[model samples]
Target: MPNKLVIYIHSGEPTQFSFAIVNGQNQLQNIHHHHDLLPQESFEEIIVIVPTEDILLTSVALPKMSRNRYQSALPFALEEQVIDDVEHLHFTAFDYQPDGQLPVAIVAHEKMAIWLQALDALSLKPTQMLPSVFALPYNEGQLQIIVESNILVRTGRWAGFASDRINFSQFLHALPVGSAPQEIEVLNFSDTSLAASQDSLFTYHEKFAASADFFPTLVQHALNSPGNLLQGPYAMKKTTLWRGDKLLKISLCLGVALFSLLFLYPTVSYFILKPKLTALNAGIKRIYQKQFPKSTAIVAPKLRLEEKLKKLAGGGDKGGLNQILSHLGQAMQTESNVKLKRFDFQNGQATIELTADSSEDFSTFTSALTNQGMLVKQQSANLVGTKINATIQVS
Candidate 1:
C-alpha cells in the first residue's frame, strides 16, 4: 500500500489492464474499474503486474563491481541460455542477493516496445513492472497454492507461475518427490479437483466472497513486493521528482510567465522613469527662474532663455545671456588648459571667474570672446597658489 497504484496487465491479443489504489495498511481503497483510459490521464508512480508468461525471471551470477558494469556483463552471461539475440532483450537485475546469484528479469525488446507504444498512447508509464504470480503468498517450509480455473503457486521470492488447468497438473507432477514442500495450503475459490483427489497432501481454506474478491490481495502484494521490471533504459526519467503529464504542466506555467514579462517590462519601466523625468524638468525651470526673475510664468526652459536673451539684446546687451554664454563656451571649447571656475550675468553684463595654466592662456580666451563681438573688461587678475585666477565683465 503506502499510497500507490497497482495495475495488472494480462497477456492477450489486445491485452487487458486492471488498476487499483491501495493505502498504507495494504487496504484497497479504490478501483477505477475501467480500461482504455484516455491519453491525458496519468499517475505519479505505478506498480505494474504483467502476466508471468510475458516476462522471464531467473538468476545470473555476477562479480562484485559497480551496478552499471555488472549490467554490461549480463547479456554475455545470459547469451547461451537465451535463444534470441542478447541485444534484442531487455535485462533488469535486482539488488544484492543473499544467494550467490543476482535476480534478473528478461523480456523481448519487440514485446516491450509494443507495450510501451500502447502506454504512450494512454500517457501511462509504470515505474515498477513485475510478473503477476508475485501476488501468490510465500511462507517458509509451506507451499501456498491457488488452483482455481487457473494455477498460481509461489515457490520462492520472485518465483511463481500462471498456467491453465491442464499444464498445471503436468508441472505439479513433474516436481521431484523428495523435494516436495513439508506443508501445503490451498486456497479454494472454485472446484478443486486436483487438491481434493489428494486431500492427504493439501489443507483447504474457506471460500471468500467471490473469486474476483481475491484481486485486491493480488494488487496489495504488488504494492509491497519488489522485482520491478524498470532498469537501465526502461527506467522512468525523473524531472524534479515529477513525471508524465505533471512535467508538461510545469513547462507550460514557465512559458506563460516569460510571455507576460514581454509586455509587463515596458509598462513597469515607463511608470518608474516618468517621475525622474519630471524631477529633471523641475530643476531646469528653477535655474531659468534664477536667470530671469521678472518672468513668473514657466513653460519651456530652452525657449524661455532664448526669449529673455532677445529682450536684452533689444536693450543693447550683446545678443543676450544665451549669446554671451555661447561665445564663452565656444572660446573655452578649444582651450583645454583654461578652466572656468564660476560665471554670473545681470543687467546686460556678464562677470566671468576662471583659472588658467598661464597668463597667455588667459589672454587667448579674452581675445576669442572679443572676436565674437562681446566687449570684455578685466576687473581683477592674479595668480592663485598653483594656477592663474582672473575675473572679467562682458556686455
Candidate 2:
C-alpha cells in the first residue's frame, strides 16, 4: 500500500477537519504526521472519513449479477426505509464478497458535493471515503465510544449507530432486544457513551488516554475500513502507462493531416491527375487523326484544333481568334521566356492569360499587340505568389 493522507471531516458549524500522513512500512514508516488543515490547504492521495451521522450504513442482499446491474437496482432496495427520493442521495457499496449481500453507505448528494467541492478547492481528491464512526476500533461485537458530545456504537461488521448524546438511550431502546450485540466493549468511557442507566451491561478499560491521538486513530481506521464510498460516479479515473503516448500519436497524425492539406496538396494532385492527362492527350490525338487522316504529325492537338477551326471559318478575314493567335504566336518568337497559360475564345471575343517576369513585360506585349492593328484590352490582373499573372482580351 502507498502512503496515504487521511482526512476526518467533522459535522456542523465551522467545519473542522483533521489529517495524517502514514507510510507503508509498519517498522520503517512509523512517522505519524498529523495536523488540522485549512480548507484552502492542498493535499493529495487521500482517504476521507465523514461523521457517521451524515451517512446511513447498511447491508442489502443484492441479487447475483454483474456489479453494474446490481448498482442500478440498489436505489429501489433502499427506497422504503429512506424517506427522501433515491435521486437525492449517493449510494456506494463495499468490495463484492462472493456472497450476494454487500455493505452500502448512503449520503445526501448535496452533502457529498459540498465535501468534494471543499477538497477540490485544495486540490485534494480522495480515493476513498468511509463513515467516521467506523474508525472506533470495533471487533465482531458491540463497541461504544464518545467523541465530544456524540455517542458512537458499532453493532456489526458493516453497521453502526451514532447520534447526539441526548438521544443515545432512546436510540438504544428503539432497537429490538435480541438484535443487540452479543458483547459490548467500551473505549474512552465517558458520560455520553455510558449513562448510569446504560453502562452496567458493558465493560470498559483503557491503559492510556486513547483519545489523545484521536485524529491519528481515525486516520488508521480509515485506512483499514472495509467499505469505500468512492464508487459509481465518484470513482477515481483509471490511468494507464501509455495514455500520454497515445495522445501524442493522435496529435501527430492530426498535425500531419493539416500540413499535408496546406503544403502537399499540389504534389498529391499532380500524381493523381498525371495519368488522366496522358490518357486525354492520347484521346485528343486519336480524334484529331480521325478528323484529318492526312496529318500524320500530331505535334500540338490544341493548335491543330484551332487551325482546323480557322480553316473552317473560310480563312477570309484575320479579324478574330486567328488574328489574336497569329500575333501572340509571333510575340512568343521575340520573347522566348513568355509562355501562354490559357487561350480561350467565345462570343466573338478571345482572352489570353499568361505568366511573365513582371507586369512591364505584359505591358510591352500589349503595346506590341496594339501596334499590330489588333484590338487588344489589358483586363484585370494581379501577381500570384512569385509569378506575375496578366490577362488580355482581343476582339
Best by TM-score: 1
Give a tens-digit lDDT track for model 1, residues 188-262. Answer: 556545555553553544343356766676776676687777788888777454565787888999899998998
- Model 1, runs deviating above 4 Å: 1-3, 24-26, 36-42, 173-179, 190-192, 196-209, 242-395
Q: How accurate is candidate 1 locally (lDDT)?
A: 0.73
Count of steric clashes across candidates, in order: 0, 0
Q: Estimate each model's TM-score.
A: 0.54, 0.53
Candidate 2 stretches with Cα past 4 Å from truth are 26-44, 95-100, 144-146, 189-210, 239-395
Top-scoring candidate (lDDT)? 1
Q: In lDDT terms, how accurate is model 2? A: 0.69
Per-residue lDDT over 1-395 for candidate 2, one digit per residue giving the tens place of the 0 to 100 score:
55657777767721456666665642122323234233333333577878788889777887677778878988999888688899998988775555767778888988888888877775677877788777767665455554554667776667787887578767766666766654544454333334444545533442223454556656666666766777898887643435787888999999999998988899989999999999998898887897678987877778878877776444446555556678877776666656688877765567788887766677677777777777888786788765578888876
Could you tell me how far off, in angstroms, the CA of residue 341 lies in candidate 2 after the best superposition? 64
lDDT of all predictions: 0.73, 0.69
